[model samples]
Target: MTEKPRMDVHDLVSEIYARDSRRVFSTLVRLLGDFDLAEEALHEAFAVAVEQWQHYGVPDNPRAWLVSTGRFKAIDALRRRVHSQDVREQVSKRLDELSQVNAERAAREIEDDRLRLVFTCCHPALSSEAQVAMTLREVCGLSTEQIAVAFLSAPATIAQRIVRAKSKIRDAKIPFDVPSVQEFPQRLESVLSVIYLVFNEGYSASSGESLTRADLSSEAIRLGRLVMELLPDPEVLGLLALMLLHESRRAARATPEGDIVLLEDQDRRRWNRTQIQEGKELVERALASRRFGVYTIQAAISAVHADAPGTAATDWGQIVALYDILLRSAPSPVVELNRAVAVAMRDGPAAGLSLVDNILERGDLAGYHLAHAARADLCRRLGRTTDAQAAYERALELAQQEPERRFLKKRLAEVV
Candidate 1:
């Protein structure tokens, strides 16, 4: 067996940070009873870890050690604040509350602290975007820039959303715990939405040089699994199935050189059949319940595509039908755009082009790069070179991801 190289204390501590920082943070959040303070404690603990671990070697339980250190750091800060007359009473009360909460915290459920944190971050008191932003920032440990790239929004915008979310939580003093069974239904949508967005960003990065953020997607999948274990809701199963099905194509979604690979051109042999099978099984389970929603229907569409031998053999009719149901249930412009692409395959490019025109005429998805790219593809297939060129140019203009931009530019060149 090959021996692993010994890392310096600094490097080892950094590795520990990458692995256990979020777990430590979660425990500290439960102990400190405040997000900002918990965050501060997390960093302080890490800074202490680098020095302490070097002098005493690594601890047998790094997470527990860090959690202990972080809680003390928070306590120290709280104590210091207690001496300030301006906020003495307020700080003293907070310290008492923390002490009591921490005492009862373990008996309640310390192991599920991260899950509780997710629910708290996804609280209904916040806006949809704020809920998503906060969960990604805190639970997933994604950076502000990373979240911004996934959302295709400006970093400043994402940062401000997160700031506002934290302010709301602080000002309102939202509890750092999971919702009750009755409260689950109300908070479920935001939670699911946050996970879905995370998966989408990881599955196909919205921007950046790389085509995929595998780490982020894997985290989302883990979160999905965790949520399913807790709730097993039909929609949750559907979402999990949808993500697995889509993720199954990860190997074939791009060239080894990191260029984009259109679904029709991807090598089916390279697909993860195991994930496909599991995803299909999940879809069946969700469908059997007769209570599934858009995600389940979407997974059904993915299953049809997965089962196909090739593009020509795909069940475009089934896909279009599923999209129809999704549209009726959700009724969004993006869904209509997708349905149009399916129609183009099931019917003809001309029929699909008509739908695309109608959507564009209504000023829907005008800023969406995929909508333009879809139109460009239909136009190209229909031999409408002029229209294809224009659509591809528009898509290229809007595309932020390097791979997508390259693909659109290539399409534009071919049409021209």
Candidate 2:
């Protein structure tokens, strides 16, 4: 059989960014001397790449080409903005100097630029939300629209957040370099959360045709791996494991027509055994450390799912026990709701209904779709078709993702 040439779009995109991301980002940072402007310039450079790559072919040194192009574009932009003769001259002189940079210096400069960008995006000056938005947009190459969707906010709001975050970083004079080991722990949680958000967005896309956003999930995993390589913490290991185990079920999470598949009904044969094995190893390692966090606990839950051969074979009692521990560690309405599901599986639907009713009565999850979905399921099981239909309608209204909404609507149809 003849071998067919294959081009991996994901790897191609990653390589293009990796090679140019630092140098181009640095050029913009140096040229505009602002994180926001540098980020904008980098976006502009990639836009041009998308346009030119079809005809020109990817350059031998695509990174260098992007850096050079972005630099000139930024210089032109700066020239247009500056009316002052002195400022123009300063910009021109800096441009000329950067153009004449030596090879060794360029390497060092690019490294400095990347390091500066990473720390700047994660600066203590910005709020955690802003830091996450800025880092995903600037460093991770996600569009503002994509970011806004991920954050469940308006695009304009996300844009403003990024702009404000950049301004804060500049005004606060946040150091461009990576923090020392002594300062790592203080900033670690924010970084981990951002990575976790990335994985989640992929696991269930905020708005997309597909059930799983593999790119976002893979990017999160990649970033997680990078962080673990740089600093191996138990929590980081746990997060990586969690993402992997969830991702392993991607193939079985939806039907051929793209309808949602509940975990119980998903074909176990379709799951990625390799990812399951890898995630299990990570969980075991994390448990051995005895220094696990919320991510580890969540990973442990996923590990239980992976261990079970089938839905009927699952240890619901063990799952309920884990949820109890999780409730103590992370007292969230979502955790409680999940516990209710486990209770239904272990004890009975009536018991689960009581738990869900208690949560809903408190108005803690007034707009959460899953809460309604859980109620609908329990009501349906108890032969309360009218109540089940109402609950499903509520779920459909609150559901953000199309697939989830469709799933709820289908459930409503089944009862009505």
Q: Which candidate is the best by lDDT?
A: 1
* Model 2: how far residue 54 lies from native, Å: 23
lDDT of 1 by residue, 1-416 (tens): 12223457788788888876877777788777788899999999999978777667777667777887888798898877675686778777767776665433442254578777888888888887898788778876889998877666899999999889888887898888878888877678779988898898788876788889887788789889877876789999999999999999999999988998888999999999999999999999999999998889999999999999999999999899899899888999999998999999989999999999899889979999899998888988989899898999888889999988888887788889
lDDT of 2 by residue, 1-416 (tens): 12222354345656777755755775467546677666667778877866666555666656666776676677677778888889888877877776675423355566556555656677777887787787777766678999876656799999999878877777877766667789876677667887887788778876767677677788788878866765689998999999999999999999878889999999999999999999999999998999888888888989999999987789888889989988998899999999999899888899999999999999999899899999999999999999999999998889888889889988899999
lDDT of 2: 0.80
Query: lDDT for every model?
Result: 0.85, 0.80
Which ranges in model 1 have alpha carbons more than 4 Å from their true place? 1-24, 39-73, 85-88, 91-108, 124-133, 142-164, 180-183
The TM-scores of all predictions, comma-separated, are 0.78, 0.73
In model 2, the Cα lDDT at residue 46 comes to 79
Model 1 clash pairs are none
Looking at model 1, report the run of 10 residues with the lowest lDDT sum.
Answer: 101-110
> Candidate 2: minimum summed lDDT over ten consecutive residues — where?
1-10
